[model samples]
Target: MRKDLHEANRLSWNAATRAHNSHKGDQAQFFRNGGSTLFPEELALLGEVHGLKALHLQCNAGQDTLSIARLGADITGVDISDVAIDFATQLAADAGIPARFERADVFDYLAHAAESSVDLVFSSYGTLCWLSDLNAWAQGIARVLKPGGRFVFIEFHPYAMVFDQDWTMCYDYFNTAPLAESGVSDYVAESGDGLAVGEYQAGEQDFVNPHASHEFTWGVGQVTTALSQAGLCVARLDEYPYANGWKGFDGMQDSGGRRMVPPTGMPRIPLMYSIVAQR
Candidate 1:
């Protein structure tokens, strides 16, 4: 892993964390009222985790993590951003949910994580790009998972990643370079999906973080192959034409819930995907 680059991203996330929350109001109250941030796709794949030891990686703000806790699972969420972890911890307390939040880089946290300590590992939504080393990630996951435990991964597909926010082709599908984004605008409420949740009405704000973020675009093949080499058996891979919340182009319609889809007649490509791999 590129520690330097990863450090830079941590700073960026710290800054972005505040910006991400700035658009929202009363997050603690939302959790207290039994609100959730999880999409239906994860719910179906999650099955039953009641009383199972679980881990949520890169859990920002812990809204979804707390939701999982509602399912009666003992879960701890880990993230690299201090601000995010702090917010998550406080939210857990405010919501009266029993959970643990740790601030650590995923790789280092995984390195020191006890082998065979967890029954399930869950990670989702815009997580992989910030990770610099997938092999180490896979090995760490393989090491931590107990016998027969599976890792549930949900993410935006790399095929859809080639297009920018405007649906224009701006990146190479096979690109292996680190993307450095500086002075980026906030995405929480900009996608129009955030406001669609019908929870507390967010306040209007223009937010931007100047910190440079170092990210990578590891494709589907690279990820599955890494897990295979790390002794994890890939049990399932599912692709969806709809995306969760973040709409990348105009004319995107709501697919009956928080999911959004491309305009009516465009060629359908995978906007998101999920994988289930067992140790």
Candidate 2:
């Protein structure tokens, strides 16, 4: 298991390293450019976090980490990508935000963190899919939380993964097969950069080899179950019909900076969910 995880981490790290390096210095810019604008609705659900001790798992390049710091949380961020961590550390230093960034697998970091050391465990979009084992992931979350500490997350709806292109749901909800998606740019790129249109780097193309990318079709039931199994009692679970980030769905419109299915209508399935669980 350790060997498998190590290999998986390597692949994910290598792929993410390039993206992290390219945008390392632009975290604040990204935020100011309407990054967290869409997120505030869901993020606001976390309530008052001023002065809280927060841990962000899979914190890529630390944009959200710094954003949370701006909210007054003493923050620590962990990611498998060394490049991401290095950039995050430098950004923190340059911005004068007192954030600690660490390079470590989430599981390893949680397993070894001093027990009950965090006031909150936070993760967001695109973070959980890389993890292969939810039970282990849950256990790690449980181990790190102090009594009454909270775990909050906002993730892409598993149902959104069913479609390869707009207007079709081609995949099974229950399938656990590792879907190898290649030849696409990193999801963060803007149009017309010239690398490959949607490709990651402008003027440069590279393949991202994700060692293990499995989407768990976790409905509300599964999400709550996993949190309960992890010993965190569910405090609140809220779902939104729209997403704060691009979800590759057709007919979805950007409203208040968030992507939403138009009122004229698409099926009202959730596009994102925020869960707050307490230890």
Candidate 3:
């Protein structure tokens, strides 16, 4: 199981690296237009971090890491993707942003980081599901945090993960079994154009590889329990019924620039959650 998890991490990080390098142009726009800023409503939930040492876990391409740096935090972004770390470092240097990025597995990185070195640990949307063991993940978070430090996360609601690709209800939300692979297009790459595969840059094709996609689902209660077991006090939790970013649902509309199930006009169930916890 440990070996399988490591291999899964390697695959995910490699895929993310290729995706970031190939889709840099679109991704930059995506972030600027609110991809990294997906939970704009929860920005204030992170509270103040000026001059604080912050670590960003699973920080693909460093958008959110740089975003935190812009707010005056001394930031270090760790990802399992060397490609992503290279691009992120270059991007930060080019933008004159003072931030550092490293390619390391989250668990390995946390294990080696000096205890109580970081004042804040931040992660966001779509990050936690990639992790196979919640307890180990939580322990790593606890190991790296300073006394009274905080860990903040914003992620896709597990309830949303239970829905089938057709956007109709399916599957057991509480089931812990690994899900079958969905050979669908990347959520961020798919817009109103309908399932565009392979990235495009300056009217030309960028990287294209089929072995680079994977997905997983995790329950909310399970995640909270892991955090508690790690000795973190849950500070605040908020669920939003709407998402301001791409949601993998057909017939979903980017209503007024925010993504939500539409036309049927149902008050969309909470699709995402943000949590703040203290060590």
Q: State which candidate has the highest TM-score.
A: 1
Once model 1 is optimally superposed onto the true structure by TM-score, how far is the C-alpha of residue 162 displaced, in angstroms? 0.6
After superposing candidate 3, which stretches have Cα over 4 Å from the reference? 1-3, 20-39, 180-185, 192-209, 212-215, 257-263
Q: What stretches of model 1 exceed 4 Å from their correct place?
A: 193-200
Better of 2 and 3 by lDDT: 3
The prediction achieving the highest lDDT against the true structure is 1
**Clashing pairs for predicted structure model 3, backbone only:** none
Worst 10-residue stretch by lDDT in candidate 3? Answer: 192-201
For all candidates, what are the clash counts?
A: 0, 0, 0
lDDT of 1 by residue, 216-252 (tens): 9899999999999999999999999998887667777
- TM-score of the candidate numbered 2? 0.82
Report lDDT per candidate. 0.86, 0.68, 0.71
Q: Each candidate's TM vs. the true structure?
A: 0.95, 0.82, 0.84
